[model samples]
Target: MNYTLRTALQGLWHDKWLNLLCTLTIATSLFLVSLASVAYINIKTISAKLPDRFSITVFLNEDLEEERIKAIISQVQKHKSVKKLKYISREQGLADLRLSLGDADYVLEGIEGNPLPPSLEIGVTRRAVSGDGVGRLVRD
Candidate 1:
């Protein structure tokens, strides 16, 4: 074993530059593989969280009666994937827009009236964000 070790060491010493190059190549490959794995994991995590951010906004006609709006709300609620529902009145939407605009709210002041429409903001389950679930919801 000692003789084998001595021979191996001699061979490595004789080809020191080649050994170093091989070592560096192997290390670089491993590092790249590790980086790719980390990137893939991070992408998967972000994609999973994407469903939580999914939402649908349904704008109602300005002249729709309260009863029709209620019916629309009921219909949306009947979907199994519906997780949360919020109704935003025209005034509330304008307020929210102003809040979001901050100092830029001056841009909205030129408008004579609230141009935003009343709408329903609907949050859905993760399953609803994938495949044909969203399509079905929109169709209904």
Candidate 2:
């Protein structure tokens, strides 16, 4: 084993530049790929384990009045498993979109006005995010 190690080291030193370059390149690529994979797994685990982080957004008819939106939210809030609800007004939604767009002037320029209306953003309690529970809320 010592002889073999000595011979391998001598051969590596013969092409030091090429060996070093290949070793560093492989190491860097492996590090980046491993890091990305770890980050992806962490993100997936986070999303899967915490279902309550997602909001169940129900969009009503565009012509629907704000009063109906409020009433729907009130009904949803009555549910024992509902954590919170948000009614996003059209203007507020538009502002959110603009903020997300980062001043991309042409992003919504073609759109004349805010088409999105006040919708119910319902946050389910931790235990109420099962498939059946979500289905019940959707059916309501």
Candidate 3:
């Protein structure tokens, strides 16, 4: 056993550069594998949370009458999967755009009028986002 140990040590010393290269290669490969695993896990976690944030935006014609808009809202509210429904007027949409734009809101000043259309923002239950519930709601 002593002789075997001595011979192994001598061999290692003779091929020090080769042994060092092999060790570095193995360590780098392990590090990359761990990094990939962490990234995959984080991506999966983020994707799972997406359903909670899922929403649908339905744009309405600029000429739609108030009664017609109310009727549409009532119909959309009848759906069981709908968690919330918000109607945004053209003015409100512009304000929201300005808020989102922050310092760049001055760029919108060049536009003659509120080009943004009135729309319905619909939020669905988490279960609805997981399957065909959103599709059925859209079709209706």
- Best prediction by TM-score: 1
Which portions of model 3 show Cα errors greater than 4 Å? 1-8, 130-132
In angstroms, the error of model 3 at 116 is: 2.6
Give the lowest summed-lDDT range of ten residues in model 3: 130-139
Candidate 1: the clashing residue pairs are none
Worst 10 residues of 1 by lDDT: 130-139
* TM-score, structure 3 vs. true: 0.78
lDDT by residue for model 2 (44-115), tens: 999887885867877767787767767777888898878998888778877887888885957788888777
User: Which has the greatest lDDT?
Assistant: 3
Root mean square deviation (Cα) for candidate 2: 5.9
Taken over the whole model, the C-alpha lDDT of each candidate is: 0.93, 0.83, 0.94
**Residue 90 lDDT (model 3):** 98
Give all TM-scores, in the order shown: 0.83, 0.61, 0.78
Question: What is the alpha-carbon lDDT of model 2 when measured against the actual structure?
Answer: 0.83
lDDT of 1 by residue, 45-132 (tens): 9988899999989899999999999998999999898999999999999999999999998998779988988999999998899669
